[model samples]
Target: MEAFTLSSDFGYVVLVVVATVFLLQWLGIQVVMARKKYEVSYPRMYSDNDDRFNCVQRAHQNTLEVYPTYLILQIFGGLYAPKLGALCGLIWLAGRVAYALGYYTGDPEKRNRGAFGYIGLLTLLVCTVMFGLSLLGFI
Candidate 1:
């Protein structure tokens, strides 16, 4: 078999992945800052005395809960349509930012502002399915 090499076409997806790492780090910092602000100890995941801190923690935790799936979809989906997948990844990233900002406001209901992120996830899901179909020779 010939040696496989990553083509420049996948550059955008690589950039998106890098950006995602920074974003997650920022979110983690936010959680740490929130913990300090609320005086929540390290062992404690949430603050019983401060719902705001809980909101911040939940925002990070929720994103983490779905992160593995996002990465999988992004990488596999990018294989089929790199630019489009990268665009969708950007959208998802933006949504997570909005979601965290809303949650930071101490109003749980405001987290809906990031609901648009699902569109990106859904599109990536479609791309992944298409990639699978193509591999199966059904496309």
Candidate 2:
């Protein structure tokens, strides 16, 4: 196995990582803004069981839940499948955005509209595991 050269190969990984981080940060900011918009007061922490706040917070938490796995799969996969990994990462970002929008609408039933993001996440997971195994001489 060849060492991952930090030239073009690692460059693609960095690009995708940065983009993913940016997307995640953007979503987090939106959650904070939602807190403000919904009148979830500061220092209180909890949303007082408010439905709008609940939806917004849950949408944000949902993203937080998947972010770590997505980042790991994305960066690891990027190391082996740069173009495809980046493309999938972009797709994942789009999925997260769709999920957020669907979940943010203050409707629990409509949240499934954003569920499509998992497809991208699963694809990334497969790519990462496959490439990772190969890198480990297991393939």
Candidate 3:
């Protein structure tokens, strides 16, 4: 059995930052939802009409929808260009955080910008995959 160490590139830093953002975003949503649930019954926990709560719920849901893809891209991209991939991942994380904050504050348009950030991440992932496949002579 062998342990895997990430390549020595700046991309690892980006991955770390992205992971941190993901964790923080997740924790924020969980803390809020848990507190709400504790205050009320589970069935009605998220039934509140407060705009902030709705915003947070939507943000969390959006994160869930995108995080998996982001993770896959981050890992593959890191393999090819750790520094560049990490930078892109960090950018994506920042965009997501911005989107969350904007949504939380009731700015719907800001979410689109965050969505756009995914483009960079996706590009990096695709390049990484292509590189990996070529390396393995699968291309």
How well is each residue in 1-139 modelled by candidate 1, as lDDT tens digits? 4454565778999999899999899999999998888999989998779899999999999999999999999998898889999999999999999999999999999999998988888999999999899777799
Candidate 2 regions off by >4 Å? 6-10
1-139 per-residue lDDT for model 2 (tens digits): 5775633756666786788677778877876887788788776555876787777777777788878888899877777677777777777777777777877787877778766767777888888898879878899
lDDT of each: 0.92, 0.76, 0.67
Report lDDT (Cα) of residue 122, candidate 3: 76
Worst 10 residues of 3 by lDDT: 38-47
Q: CA shift at 101, candidate 2, in angstroms?
A: 0.5
lDDT of 1 at 125: 95
Q: Order of candidates by TM-score, top first?
A: 1, 2, 3
Candidate order (lDDT): 1, 2, 3
TM for every model, in the order presented, reads: 0.95, 0.83, 0.71
Per-residue accuracy of model 3 over 1-139 as CA lDDT, tens digit each: 5455666685575556558665666746654764474453444435354555556667777776877787777777777777777777777777777777677665666567567677667777786788688667798
RMSD of each: 1.7, 2.3, 4.3
TM-score quality measure for candidate 2: 0.83
